[model samples]
Target: MGRSGSCLCEAITYQIPESSLMEAVCHCKNCQKQAGSAFSTLAGIKKSDFSLTGKPKLFVDKATDSGASVERYFCENCGSPIYSALPSQPDVIYLKTGTLDDTSDFNPSIHVWAATKQNWVEIDSNMPQLQKQS
Candidate 1:
């Protein structure tokens, strides 16, 4: 069986056929604004193993500090973020872990954009962190 997730209103549903290639947390400014939280939990999956059932609206984010465009996809009905696609990495889609039906297995092995992370947010020292994506 695959992993499944849906938007808040259940308007948008998705499935990933296998385990994620990577699990990570992003503390970038634009991700914070879009998630309305300190950070975004992400699961990176291969594009070939992903499937979506509903039409999600896309916002091309061009103001990223990384200087790479990010396509943020969300549910129009509930305004819940679903996933983000990177222009530089077309083979992967970073799913918003909060949307997953069960996140017990979600543990980020890495953290990115640590330089912009909120001071109040304490990151696990055991996990690798990057000041910026290299």
Candidate 2:
């Protein structure tokens, strides 16, 4: 069975593979701002394994620290973030796992852009964290 998730208003829904290539937390400032939280929970899934229902508007972010354009897709009606993809890498799509129907299995093994992580948020000492996504 496919994994399911939806936007805040349910205006947009999605189905992903039973698992993802990677699960990570992004502490980039832009991601934090977009998520309205400390960081963004991301699940990288192959483009071929991802499917969507309803129309999600796209915002192409060009001013990224990594110099890569990020195509952010979201529900226009409810303004809930859905996913993001890099123009340079079209084969992979990063879904906002916060929208997942079941998050009990959402285990993030890595943290990226930790340099910008909020000081108040303490990460587990055992997890691998990077100052940036290099």
Candidate 3:
């Protein structure tokens, strides 16, 4: 089935095209901070496959490691993070997986930024954990 998601307030909704790419979870410190959790789950989709129904406020944060600029889009009213786009990688968009209607099927093929992960967070032993995005 095709994937669809929306912001916390439901003001912003999006649909991933059938040909969209897979999803992944990022364990980077910046992702953790932005998500206010152990990690951030993102559905990587083509730029054209993703569309926003509402206007979201954008925040630009510089990556600590790569020094690349990451754009975080969130709901202005609810302050719920919606998605992210990196300057270094312009072809793809990382949609916040939490916003998806069905998260049961979503899985992370690899974990990035595992070095900065929280001590209490336990990751799957089978998945490849990289110190940083490779």
RMSD of each: 0.9, 0.8, 1.6
What is the Cα-based lDDT of residue 27 in candidate 1? 96
Q: Kindly indicate the candidate among 1 and 3 with the higher lDDT.
A: 1
Q: What clash pairs does model 2 have?
A: none
What is the per-residue lDDT of model 1 for residues 54-102, given as tens digits with 9 covering 90 to 100? 9999999999898888999999899999999988899999999999998
Error of 2 at 31 (Å): 0.4
Deviating ranges (above 4 Å) for candidate 2: none
36-79: candidate 3 lDDT, tens digit per residue = 99999887888877776999899998755657778999999887
Taking all chains together, each candidate's TM-score versus the true structure is 0.97, 0.97, 0.91
Misplaced by over 4 Å in model 3 are: 18-20
Error of 2 at 3 (Å): 0.8
What's model 2's overall lDDT? 0.92
The per-model lDDT (C-alpha) reads: 0.93, 0.92, 0.83
Query: Cα lDDT for residue 114, model 2?
Result: 93
